[model samples]
Target: MELDFILSKEEKGPSGKTELIYDLAIIGGGPAGMTAAVYAARKKINTLLISKDLGGQVLWTTEVENYMGYQYIEGRQLMDKFKEQVRHFPIDQEIGEEIEKLDKGEKFFSRNSDGEIS
Candidate 1:
């Protein structure tokens, strides 16, 4: 059965199936995840970023002092910059949704919080 959800525009294959493939799938939108996305994009890899929301624990931080390039920056501001950098690349994002399950086989299959697979 086909899932009703469309993860991304490139998800549908010639057979009309949601067969999107990616060289990397970052499960969170935290500082680490965002960094990984940027690196993967720089490497010209087909990448997907899935997260309930961006920023992660960093969003809760009031001030960011160790984030390089800036002596001090607000957490939100830092996250915004990260978001902007990630968006500048050709990376696929699935934000505002949580992954309910991940099945590993010849390929990885992920089910979102809404029970939709992509």
Candidate 2:
């Protein structure tokens, strides 16, 4: 998967905004999706991670300590760290965006509610 275009605010405003193309279009930004973004970006793939929320599943938890390196930390705190790490790369992250559809092509395409392509 590869991202071919990033819908600019101007483009989205005029096109009835729809569809996006990406090398890797991850639908969620939980630990899994964010982690994938980190790896995909490291490999130099055009990656886009669009999620309704940044920390999926894990955000609801009060505490988490079993993962690694940290003796104890809140779930939100850990997820924040994960997000920060992924941000170190050139991954295109779209938060608070809900994916209405995903069409796989030579490149993956995603459409959000605002008709903007990610």
Candidate 3:
């Protein structure tokens, strides 16, 4: 399977820098995180989703048979379905990237110092 770093919106600042403003920031690309991002986007919230990999452990699984919807499904295939839904929205993703440092200011959430969000 091919894992692409799906993304858009460069968001360069005055000096070609990135902005550090987001109403929502998701740090994982698992089912839960993706679901959160989908919900946030549906609400028209400014959100950024960063993750080292898209499927996480789910991609390593040989088969997922217990899930309600489908009778049987391969891990990679299921993940692709999730990815399809995710791609339907304008969700920004930082694939193959990990959060190195996190700093919280006087604000509500912290920014990704490495420009993952900031």
lDDT of each: 0.79, 0.75, 0.72
Top-down TM-score ranking: 1, 3, 2
lDDT of 1 by residue, 1-118 (tens): 1222323334655578667666677888999999999998898877888899999998999998966799999999999999999989998888887887887655467788788875
List the candidates' TM-scores in order: 0.77, 0.70, 0.73
Query: Candidates sorted by lDDT, descending order?
Result: 1, 2, 3
Error of 3 at 27 (Å): 0.5
The runs of at least 3 residues in candidate 1 whose Cα sits more than 4 Å from the true structure, single-residue gaps closed, are: 1-18, 114-118
Superior by lDDT: candidate 1 or candidate 3: 1
Clashes of 2: 6
lDDT of 3 by residue, 1-118 (tens): 0121223333554467664456667888988888898998998876778888888788998899978798899999998998989999988788877765665544333344355543
Best candidate, lDDT: 1
What TM-score would candidate 2 get against the native? Answer: 0.70
Model 3 residue 75 distance off true place after TM-score fit, in angstroms:
0.8
